[model samples]
Target: MGKHALLSASASKRWLSCPPSARLEEQFRDEAGGSPYAEEGTAAHALAEHKLKKALKRRSKRPVSDYHCDEMEECTDGYVAFAMEQVELAKQECKDPVVLIEQRLDYSAYVPEGFGTGDLLIVADHVLTVIDLKYGKGVAVDAERNPQMMLYGLGALELFDALYDIDIVRMAIYQPRLESVSTWEITVPELMEWVEMELKPKAVLAIKGEGEFHSGDWCRFCKAKNTCRARAEEYLKLAQMEFKAPPLLSDEEIVEVLKVADELAKWSADVYAYAQDEAVTKGKKWAGFKLVEGRSNRKYTDEEEVAQAAQKAGYTDIYKKTLIGITEMERLLGKKKFAEILGKLVYKPQGKVTLVPESDKRQEIAASTAEADFKEE
Candidate 1:
């Protein structure tokens, strides 16, 4: 189908985690704002492609040594700089390095049922090496069996099958930021299975706008933060446990209590749905729970206001709050350093506000307030 209809290797896994509606929302936004991690990885790919192609043209000339060393202007900039260096180093070493095909190769059909773009494709000694670059911090990429890389290999095999004596499709993950390389060989049948099993259904669902909600740590980053039933249940119980007073259970007992919490969570959703219906139909109030629709928290407004206030309080420069996005820090301090700060920014909804828990407090608290008024002196 089209780019909008197609599911990439990464987005396919995301589709398995949550139902189609949620997955579609995420996949579409991917094009709109371009994820920081993706942007860096793509930039690295572009830089590698550029340097490799330049080296190919000068295969007969002296090596181009004037490398751009500006202190990684951004995530993409860092990846491009580091990757370009590697390409130059390769150029010096290899006697007959192949062409560095730029972003022109569209290897969609090679991925079986899935469609993916190969980052860099090279040809040497009649063998094809498809190198995929990963610029994220969490996990070191393994190329040998990477679904994405495999698909890229499949694409390359198809494109160059007739031109050269195809020996083998070699796949690699050039994780520059991690200072490592992972690689694998792609057999024809294995690639076919990936297409039939993983690619086809995921693509269909993605195109049709349906997704399955599977849960794990990735749920924390999901955009449908408040809407997920399983996530909602977990957080609601955690909040309730926080407010629990007296007779605190031991660790083992706490685990047992969580089983009961699961039951309570189901009742809670049912109750919430009933309340939402009443609010909309009977009470004529907006029904759905209040969500964090893009919060621009902690601005220099308070800083500016405070700075102005401080100007009156006898201070000149209270310096604008040095706010930095997590992505920027990753470029400056590297991925390891940036992750420390990013951990705190995970999405946790304001679960209580606009929430109609089982208990209503006004009637129960009115008598206590009246008693307190009479008892006060």
Candidate 2:
């Protein structure tokens, strides 16, 4: 697998769950550097590294990026502050705490050529902590039983287990955008037990592409998600499953539908987008679907000219003015200044309740009154 490992630590979730997907995804190589979101995440990581290095008293130059903004600055500052806190905690037990920023960790001992770059690694006292920064806010990341963090912990152990006699492994995910700061601690023996019993076997199957294809939440980041047959089958099954019940659905049936509703909608949208692109770009057509001119709203060729003409014609009411949104206002003023100036003026109303699966980590709302309380000013 050239420079990229077949069982890369970042993609471990997909491979470990559905080992065959590792090779299946090899056929669909994404475009260079992936999507705009990926590029933004890369920049965030670079900025984080610069900030953390400087915080640790190491010489480093500040990074320049289009993504550099108040939000990125605030997030990176939070990350550095967290790392410094860990360092101080480490100092309580050990004379010298080793902190590595943007550390290249190799866990090839457990998996074939398995290596990943961790955002931060702190080796102090008997704790080996691996902290990672996730810049995206689309999905919240959890540190509990996360393969990526576990793998990073293993790589850190390989480097300092003997030197520090590390007994405990701690992994944290610092996702500032989601306001997520999750940390999970495990004993060295417990981590190794998981490696030997679960990870090693999964790695072996993933390298050979010998295991069955299983689909779940892990399919989100898979490269072949849009085109994979297994995913299509899964979503199709979910969609068809919805309508097969009786006219008046039972409580159990309603619960079952809720499990797959969100996933089904996402899959349908992805398939439609891919199909539309293929029909337009490659002249690929499906028998049932046909190309047609999509609906569009009218627009002026030159807005300034149109405005001038309208004013000259005694029609000066073309403008519609409104106050900027809360987000825009916050962006206009920096987060701190915004809070200081308008904190009392702003109030978050109660959110309307929605039915989500039990596994959702969000606290259950008081549905009895939540919907009644939702209102617009």
Enumerate clash totals for all models, in the order shown: 8, 0
Per-prediction TM-score: 0.49, 0.94
lDDT of 1: 0.54
Worst 10 residues of 1 by lDDT: 64-73
TM-score of model 1 vs. true structure: 0.49
Worst lDDT 10-window in candidate 2: 368-377
Candidate closest to the true structure, highest lDDT:
2
Residue-wise lDDT of candidate 2 within 1-377, one digit each (tens)? 13667788889999999999998888985677568898899899999899888887899998899988888888888888988998888888788889898888899999988998888888986989899999999988889999999999999999999899899998899998888999999999999999999999999999898888887889888877778888888767755654654657877877777788788788778778888988999999799989999899999999999999999999978999999988788877878999999999999965556778888887987765665665431
Off by over 4 Å in 1: 1-5, 16-23, 26-46, 58-98, 104-115, 124-126, 165-167, 217-226, 230-377
lDDT of 1 by residue, 1-377 (tens): 23532445554345544546444355433336666665555555455555455544543322232222222224434444544554454456444545455333434563224556666666544456776666666767566566566656666766666776656667766655566666677655666777788765665665566656555444534455335666556555555555444366666656656555544555466557656655665874554554234556765556658878989989986665877865465556655555676756645542222222244332334556656655663
